[model samples]
Target: MNIYAIIETGGKQLRVESGRFYDIRHFASLKSQNLSSNTKILIYRVLLICNEATISLGQPWLKNAIIKGRILHSHLENKITVYKMNSKKKTRCKFGHRQNSTRFVVDSISLNGKEL
Candidate 1:
């Protein structure tokens, strides 16, 4: 099935298609400007048509749309870790890391029980 959809993820909206991967941190997408006026933009992936709906507009989920995808690998992010220790008394500290990422492609987008 193929169709259009507007998926909100990572505090953003994406008009994505199938067989693609996109970075969510960059803000906005290929057709729209970033909602944050102070943020930069990057098109990490391409959105292919996955539905019968026109490329004009649609609901967040394309009105009964099914967007499928795969884990086309993971995003590249800086490794972050922190740790601290104290002597004598007995104290300690620690930290962790996170690899920012975006959403995968819509392997298939279906609307109204139909694939376009």
Candidate 2:
């Protein structure tokens, strides 16, 4: 049966499927752990999951439901220009920002105490 799950990470909710890759925001403190690009990680905050015709929902987060994934890579996002200008004051400020993000590949989904 085809299975998928919704997980929360980096203050965002994402719909993920097994064997697929997604780019997500990086954790601030994870850099201290010296995580490699191929590191495997388990995310336990599953919000919802659907297996074939059956669905399970969590009241915030599901117990015993987890998403296993691997870190494919990490990179910075495209730079965005922030421009602030005043019409009469003749003040113009410009800045560039780039966000750090990580690429993750979902390996498996475990639900109801079993891996699917």
Candidate 3:
């Protein structure tokens, strides 16, 4: 069995596994610094983690849990169209929006006093 963790990011919960890549909402300001493909970051908002038979849960977030990952790239999310119409009032509105997001590759997961 493999170890996995549940994390909260971008107002959503995601189940992430080690050595994999996932897309998450962008929260960093990269306007002043240059980024490379190997730049690493730490994610600390771990809610839960299960390793085979042992399970760890946090009231809100684990105090000493950390997930190490590297930024893969940043891109715009898919455009979503919102349409509103009224039959008798003759009102119509259409709008489209695209959200900024980033991709990260998980490197490792560690906990306080233990390593997995």
Could you say which candidate leads in TM-score? Answer: 2
Instruction: Estimate, for each residue in 29-102, the C-alpha lDDT of model 2 and write its tens digit.
Output: 36725557888788988999999988999999999898888888888899999999999999999999999888
User: Lowest-scoring 10 consecutive residues by lDDT in candidate 1?
Assistant: 36-45
What TM-score would every model get versus the actual structure?
0.44, 0.91, 0.84
Candidate that beats the other on TM-score, 2 or 3, i.e. the better one: 2
Q: How many backbone clashes does candidate 1 have?
A: 7
* Clashes (candidate 2): 0
TM-score head-to-head 1 vs 2, winner: 2
Between candidates 2 and 3, the one scoring higher on lDDT is 2
- Residue range 1-116, candidate 3, lDDT tens digits: 47999988777899999999999776343431434566788788899999888899999999899988888887889999999999999999999999877888988888995767
Ordered from best to worst lDDT, the candidate numbers read 2, 3, 1
Cα deviation at 104, candidate 1, in Å, is 2.1
RMSD of 2: 1.7
TM-score for candidate 3, residues paired by index: 0.84
Model 3 clashing residue pairs (backbone): none
TM-score of 2: 0.91
